[model samples]
Target chain A: MNSLEFYVDHLFRKYKASIQIQDLRFEVLGNLEAKVADLTANGVGYDEAVRMAKENLPSIDHLIDGNRTIYINQFRLEYVQITLLYMVIGWIVAMPLQFIRTGFIHWLFLISSAIIGVVYLVLLANRKNINMQKIKAFNLNAVFDLRKQVWLVWFIFIGMSIFITTALQFGSNIWFFRPVDISGPYQFAMIAIKYLIPFASIIVPVIFHIAPKLIMKYEVGENDGYKE
Target chain B: MGDNSISRDIIRGHIDAIILRVLCEGDNYGYEIIKAIAKNSDGKYELKEPSLYTSLKRLETQKLISSYWGDESQGGRRKYYKVTSLGEEAYEKSLADWKIAKDLIDKLIERQD
Candidate 1:
């Protein structure tokens, strides 16, 4: 296992599944191979050393993916907070567009738009909240376990959203303003309003949500307090 | 460390200096460095693989050591390392530090025997 390229080729066939190394993760593998060679310097042969090296290198994806689950779960917590805040804020703003002005037709558009915003937030949260456990349940071959709390989280979320939205729909304070005709520009505005909040949630959190997890997953084990 | 308890760590920290001192005039690999350490200390000192590799990585990171490929009939390929100019400076510093420490220790440990 002295020459890393030669050692990797030999070990790749022995792993049972044919895998192509896709990422820049070969450096870690190389360093591990070097360690294996060093260990067997006096005892095992080169072939044995290579086998040991491969055994030591569990899936890089699993190692990084497990860490990613933790980051994303926390990110979802932040996202859920922001999304709930947005809904509260949207309702405050749409109140003016609804009861204050009391346009006859604005009530229909307002309620529908708010429904869409709340639904979008719940759906996005559900998708991203998938923890490693569910990922394992989905794929049994997973070498690493994702944090378990995320599954309970999404269930609670969907259950709460269902309860809240249904309660709001049947609430006692059903004050309908004058019905606005949602057939022309009002229809288009309604459609835009439905999608706008969701789009912002997706885009704003895209950078925070995607970048930190990628960096964490592919971490080189910097000397941070974390075990990595 | 030559089985001496008191100055072991101080001597161990100079492993780079000791290896580079041997490799200064010639390129050497791992086993060669281990053998040189043993020989210099009259078979009293030895370097474990972890110590050797850790020092190598540390030196390389500091640009004080450079490595190249070596072909061998027994092994497929080995990385042969040489001390760089920066490594020479590190070796000199290690030597001076050791010399100062040795003088102070000898003075303290000296007896009328």
Candidate 2:
């Protein structure tokens, strides 16, 4: 309603609405109003009273740090879970495709998927400890900078994928060039599709896992910000 | 009346205790608490709102004080804080501690002759 009230509300704009936060906000706003009322009653002008009240308010950093730990932890857990879910989904989609083309399930594909699944479970189990480490290592500036470079990370990943696919296709003398007796464009295309399915299954998960960490690494430097 | 940084830092450390002492007189809301501090100090000290809120939260977390919404008839409902029994004990402990510290500091800093 007044300048003090507006400023207090603005400060907490980013926080999600919850009972605890709402209670804190209500308490803070009431205090600011009372301070302004008292100051103005004592002959201080409304503008000066508002300014003094605002100046007395504590920094948002301390307030957020004290109150938002649980919310931040839940967000981090969800981020990890979603990333792992994408990996699992990639494997699930690839497994049947591989079987349909090759006439048999790929053992390597199955094993790697199981490994990634296990890693996912282990990460989930140790999430609390990992979250504590993350909080300790967090740098606000670095995180913002890392977020800005996300597009570059994806571009590099796509480039690497193209290079790997091209090398495997030609270097083995398989897809683009094959033995004269067995060579045919149809067979070459089918083989390339089969290999590409497996390659994608692996690469997609690897990229999903590495992209965020890569950004974190670039921002905070290797072995310094996050240990695992 | 002088706003020296060192004195302010010392006062900040005892903000929770100072707040508890204010509550001992009567239950007060946020603004009233600040006014009480200013009144008690004869306008010599004014606790900033941020530090005051932080200390209030810390005290609430420690269970030394409790807060509740007051049913104001107009404007907005105000939140009032009351010192718990635990807070009273803490206040006494902090007061004694301050006295000892004050006496010790005076002795240490007093000019010779």
Candidate 3:
């Protein structure tokens, strides 16, 4: 019976519980236990009975159909919203520094920020259509297993950023830290890129590491509300 | 077993109807309903647990049935499902539709010779 519960739980591990989902879970476990019991009573061994009971059920994909689509759409929305937020925040943070040091804000960065903001608003407005596309494209299993890989990528990103930045800061005559001889737009471009690199290196990794888990936590909370 | 796949595909199309017909006999919990279907088919057909719940959910959403948790003195608590008046009407309609489909298919596919 415990094994029966384990099997059903494993199949649904990716899904968050709602009232309907919870009821369905218990119903599935109860039916599976009954099937196993009947099979065992008819002289089938315990392990075989469990296996047969599992085999009699349909695939998890077939079972999840509609409910799973809701979660997938939510996940995609969270991913896009978080990415846009990070981009906007990155540009805003860089703006003040550019103004304070260079006596003017960089137009390129400001324009990029505006573009990102527009994109974010468009996404918010057309979320339903985007979600439909996502339902067809996103792989739920990969998203469920993403937290660990996200962390690993974050670590590698941080390590590489630190190594490159340290080498640039200390290495003899590295253009990154050296005083620029040019006096026009080329100089501004160089300084902007140099400043942007370290900021991006620090910020992008942190966002990558944190965003998925944040979305997952929000999904769990949303589902928790539906629990009876 | 080889022919079971093709038959199962045909059965899959009417899983909801089949489940509703079982509940038409009496209110039943998940396991009992599954067993009844299997028993009636002489073990030739067995609905998978997930598929059963999935159909049950669709039926519930359509207001064809309602469910309640059963208090079992032993083992785990069970969720029982009862057919709604709406469900009984849907079941009858589904049965009538199936008969028409079955007869049409039989006539169209049968050998004249």
Best by TM-score: 2
Superposed by TM-score, candidate 3 places the C-alpha of residue A132 at a distance from the truth, in angstroms, of 19
Residue A148, candidate 3: C-alpha displacement in angstroms: 25
Instruction: Give me the displacement of residue A86 in model 2, in angstroms.
Output: 24
DockQ of each: 0.05, 0.22, 0.21
Clashing pairs in 1: A104-A178, A104-A179, A104-A180, A105-A178, A105-A179, A105-A180, A132-A146
TM-score of 3: 0.52
Please give, for residues B1-113, the per-residue lDDT of candidate 2 as tens digits: 34676776677678889999999998988888988998999988987666677678889999999988999877555899999999999999999999999999999999879
Query: Residue by residue across A65-112, what tens digits does model 1's lDDT show?
Result: 122223334344454455455445545554554533444234443554
Worst 10 residues of 1 chain A by lDDT: A132-141
Report the lDDT tens digits of candidate 2 across residue range A1-228.
767668978878877777887887888887777878888999999999888878766345445432221224444555555555655666566665664555233554466567766766776788767654333223344444555565456567667776776675565666547653436987676656644653454444454444445334323221122111
TM-score of chain B of 3: 0.95
> Comparing candidate 1 with candidate 3, which one achieves the higher DockQ?
3
TM-score of each: 0.39, 0.54, 0.52
B72: Cα error in model 3, Å? 0.7
- Stretches off by above 4 angstroms in model 2 are A65-228
Give the count of colliding residue pairs in each prediction. 7, 2, 2
Error of 3 at A61 (Å): 6.3
Residue B54, model 1: Cα distance from true site in angstroms: 1.3
lDDT of candidate 1 over B1-113, digit per residue (tens): 46675455555657778778877868877656766777888887666544555466667778888877666555334567888998899888888988898899798989848
